[model samples]
Target: MELLAWGNTELDSSWSVTEKSNCSYIRIYHLTSGSICYSDTAMSCALDTEAVYILPSHAPFTMKPAPGTDTHCTWLHMNIYPVLVKELLSIPYTQKQALLFSLMRCIMEEAYPPAASLSHCAEIFIQDLYQMGCLEKPDPAFSPVLDYLCVHFSEDISISDTARQFGYTPEHFIRKFKKETGSTPYQFLTGYRMGKCCELLRKGYPVSSVCALTGYHDIKTFDRAFKKYHGRTASEYQKYFKKIYP
Candidate 1:
């Protein structure tokens, strides 16, 4: 997932937007209040309160405020390849959802310092949509990159090597990567490793395994980084969340 833009938007009776072609990026709108009606040359979808709306790239459409209501929503603009627009279009607007608030929180967190993993948030967003049966395709170009990182993060991988695997030069890769995901490779790796550590620890994996699993050859280094990133030592963090975990 390549993040182009993300934030909140409030639309009133006067609000309207029209897209010509897929417009290079897809937009996902998680409506928190009010309503909206979407239309295209083919058909329309009446989007009501607390719904997720997906506008796929290259699919021309227009969105307008629904009758007599204000609309409040958070939106994410991204490039998700092989988008299942038809599948997304057919989903019920008020379907039960998951990860909406958490994903938003991550987006907000990445907007500030110590900010990491906006890219991961995007991946989670995709995962949620896919889980909800909204997004059907998993052929996005970035999937391989993410999969590789997750499976091999324990190895001493470097940016240039990772970039080359993706068929890009070092300098160009950084620019392209940052543009697509809002994070550098190293930053993403740190966040990814920390996340993996958190998960493994939650699942009763010992810290030593997590150290190797996350590619930290040194226990002390891993401990310090874990503390800094999560604001607690691994033991403490695990203990804190363990009660809530079940």
Candidate 2:
């Protein structure tokens, strides 16, 4: 999923919204107070209290905010870029909301211009919700396995092992993983490792230590992938880098 735009807004008593055309974006709303009616092609729900809503991309939606002395909700608009999660979701108060609140603070404060850090925070928040079994289960064909890959990216995982874990044959696993993620499992693992390397290196981890901790067998191979993926060496990034999660 790709984050397109995010911010917070409070609609007062006179709040209003109109029906619109097709939407290529998924909207997330956290009702801090008051209420609103949300409707789309696939589902319709009310943000009547302290609740969170995740609307699907490409599903047109209209908002009908309730009128009162004090009425408001905060919303986030994200472009899945390609639809990953398959349904609209409304999650009520839960422990996971604490994580969402933390991420919201990061998105609001740390993500001033909204770059990689913001994306990373948002992804983490959403993934938490998914793991909480709140959002509609993802595409059964590949979504669950993708989640497994994301959560366990740091572990020494193999395609054959993961495929078998997901009850798929090795041959079928390669095809499905490639088709859904646009990269083989190994390639995706490498990319995830590299992203983590960037994160750690930027955080002042020593080169040799980072290499070893990131599961790199040697600095040479690590350097190769780092330079190839980031177009710069790890040390270079540490000296002149901004936290961007890619």
At residue 207, candidate 2 shows an lDDT of 86
lDDT of 2: 0.65
Give lDDT tens digits, candidate 1, residues 91-179: 34433243544556455644241113545666766786688776554346767876787688788888898889899899998887555
In candidate 1, how many Å is residue 182 off? 26
lDDT of each: 0.66, 0.65
lDDT of 2 at 152: 87
In candidate 2, which residue ranges exceed 4 Å CA deviation?
A: 13-21, 41-44, 84-87, 106-114, 132-246
- Evaluate model 2: give its TM-score: 0.47
Candidate 1 accuracy as lDDT: 0.66
Q: Number of the top candidate by lDDT? A: 1
